[model samples]
Target: MRPATDLAAGRPAAPAPGPDLPLDGLLRRAAAVAPDRVAIRTPLGDTSYADLDAEVDTAAGALTAAVGRTGAVVGVVASLDVPFVVAYYGAVRAGHPVAVVNPLMGDDALVHALGTAEVAAVVAPPRVAERLELLRPRLPKLGGVITAERLPTGLLPPGERGPAADLDAVACIQFTSGTTGAPKAVRLTHRNLVANAAQIAAVHGLDGDSVTVNHLPLYHPMHLNSAVYAAATQVLCPDSAPTAAVTAANRHRATHLYSLPVRLAALAADPGLGELRLDTVRAVLSGGSALLPAQARALSDQFGVPVVQGYGLAETSPLTHCERPADPRPGSVGRPVPGTDCRVVDVAGRFALPTGERGEIQVRGPQLMAGYLHEDGPATDPDGWFSTGDIGYQEADGHLFLVDRLKDVFKHENWLVSPTEIEQVLIRHPAVLDCAVADHPDPSAGAVAHAFVVLAPDAGPLDGPNGPAAFVNGRLPYYQHIRHLDVVDRIPRSPNGKILRRTLREAAAAAPTDRPPGDPT
Candidate 1:
């Protein structure tokens, strides 16, 4: 492993708050300091910090009455709206670990997530509530389903608070995105959430004066917690159109713009992009997946602001590294955030590798999770280092560059082939709007790279000599060359914007041998 001194060389220090603060205390502190500040703005309405805090208190009281016990898990469907924010904080304030359920999940996936968490109660919007009503029989432990409309009625006394929770106790449970395998429930403590909030706010340079635009389908806790921790204002934009988010940012005079890589790529491709003016926006931030360097450069050049990205998983409070806004790097996720240590280890063994060598990324930090649900103890080694299962490399100065998921990498002729490496080259072609790469079985070579591409609207024939296949193959080595290429209207992605490689790989394996070929082998 890299020396401790080397890892900590230029990283910032931990936030001012100690590790003892409760998760709900983030809202309380923000409300106390700026009670009248506009905390959130949505198309429906606006909410002040004082009003939001009071609503959380009422919701907490109601949840206390509904759950009838402390420490029971509460499932909260995480939609990007004001009620979700209330229920999420309310559950934590009521001394319950809130299991954040993605509202877009299918019935079986939803049941699996809630069942695995053993959720005793759930707070959801009307749609999710209706679905939960049908699944309640499967969840015998579930005692109640509270809708957002009922959260403000205060079923119990308004001032009632649950028992004080320990800082190290599990405060939130987030299931993985399941892009690789079955989603696992990750347990994050109050300390982990709080520390990460502070770390994110510090890295993003958020303060009371900052305003942010969240243009996502589901509200991620990382963005919500960090905004509350910094007492910054948030404008929730539910519209999926890339231009709508930009318009919202301009309307709110937002200082930071947070979006997914998929959305940003769309924004980069939008013809109206050149006409939009992000006069007040300082930075455009993306996460959940790597934003293509070409897309990032397009946005940076158009808006005249830095486009930054970060890296983390559900196991690490969702944030470990964030690119510096002032000095953004095009293709790097930047160094580890304050109070975090990251190193690359050999994939087959626990031994650390030298700088610039591709290996599994392992992380150690205050923001790491306690463990996955049903696990015995913290999911780390004796020394507290957690293997991230991501293949990456770090520069001598500590900037991390992701190669691909370790499991997603396949071998061809005994040589490891990174799908992302091929995808990156494919996307650089002007005609290729988006793309995904997966391995197809081969008797002699073990596996060959198969690519699925979404072409630009005005692009011409793809099977010609100058097609994407020839374009990408010319830039790659023999083993990494694209063997099969298919054109699709869109690439399949999870709700959180991760490319569904498993799905694509399945399609590739089941494809007929008479399909179109890429380059003349």
Candidate 2:
């Protein structure tokens, strides 16, 4: 590994163990431990732990007064800015559940989130605030929009609040990415967020001294809560450019680098990559989607730092398994963190499978959410195990390798076909830049694999006999072959970087066939 140095770094003090506290308590504890230390470093400025705590208190008073009561749901536009962070914890501190909304959502989707969440007030950016006004007629529960600058403050005296909040109360309502359908709100309690934050900190080996650079498009609660729980400093790199992110980490002597899989792949493919260095970065972490194993190895080899990935959903406080830095695995998402149990269940969803047997993955843990918002009850079974709806298998050594989503898998002539497995193989082709496979309806075969491919810019078109469909067919088994192919410029992806397979499925099903008779389809 390349040598690292810390210019203005000091060890962060560890948090003391106690009863399960609310998510906002993370900021308070960090303040108590290191009041003068820098808690957040943004491109514009830095905020000390003490100042951040005070701001939260101030913002809490403003938010509570604006909402007019406790327990009101506040919709927060989750921008990767300092204001959003203050409002997120502030609303929670005032005894209200915060629903984090994607700022990039369309007007219709944003209206849906606000109306479904039943938010009394919204803390949003200037642009999103205007959009909320346009959507206000559709959202009956929405009382008003509160800008970051206009929140009421100084109503509550400093250091005069009551005891730690009840752990069972819902702290935040996280919505799932609606790549396939409408988003569902996951009700997360103080206990759920706190437990997962601790679990993440422990597994990632975070200490007060650790400095993480966040380059994701939006602020994720997993990164926010974990950093606060460990009293670690976080540097926000707002730039989407891969080299810019690396430069920010190097500038701050950041110990951890968090990013999305799409950005990492671009970083690995950058021609100017050889000029940059990550001397202070300990590890590069990817999530939201699977990072290509080849890209992971390339980045690790070039930077002399491990490139690791993790697995989870909004329903599980977003973390269950993570690759270990010490003995990193290239393709696996690594073992489950402390206090989490993972098992593979057969297609029937009743029988547990042996190691290496592919099945639906299920998990039970303290980090599990309380329930879905406005739903009857939690999705978990009576024993607290929640089926993840993901098809994968566990290894003897405990690593998890995800094959594909249960809904995305299909059967061809009594043989199960994994779209992800085929996509992985297709991506290895010399001309293929990215690809997605979906089942196309057929008269005899029931369904056949169809591919949507994005070729490399310089790579010549493979329109002849040696195209992707033929190339992939030669490599994969008969059941896993790509029956049809369409070249596209780009693959549609959600804001968080997950491929929109549902979109591809519709396109593939609509395309007319041009092949000879008795082909795969």
- Compare the candidates by lDDT and give the number of the best one: 1
lDDT of 1 by residue, 413-513 (tens): 88989999999888878888889999988777898899999988888767666888888888899899888888888999998778899999998899776
Global Cα lDDT for candidate 2: 0.84
Error of 1 at 510 (Å): 2.1
TM-score, one value per model: 0.94, 0.94
**Model 2 TM-score, all chains together:** 0.94
Off by over 4 Å in 1: 1-19, 153-159, 513-521
Q: How accurate is candidate 1 locally (lDDT)?
A: 0.88
Provide the lDDT at 309 for model 1: 93
Write down the TM-score for model 1.
0.94
Q: What C-alpha lDDT values do all the predictions have?
A: 0.88, 0.84
Candidate 1 displacement at residue 515 in angstroms: 7.7
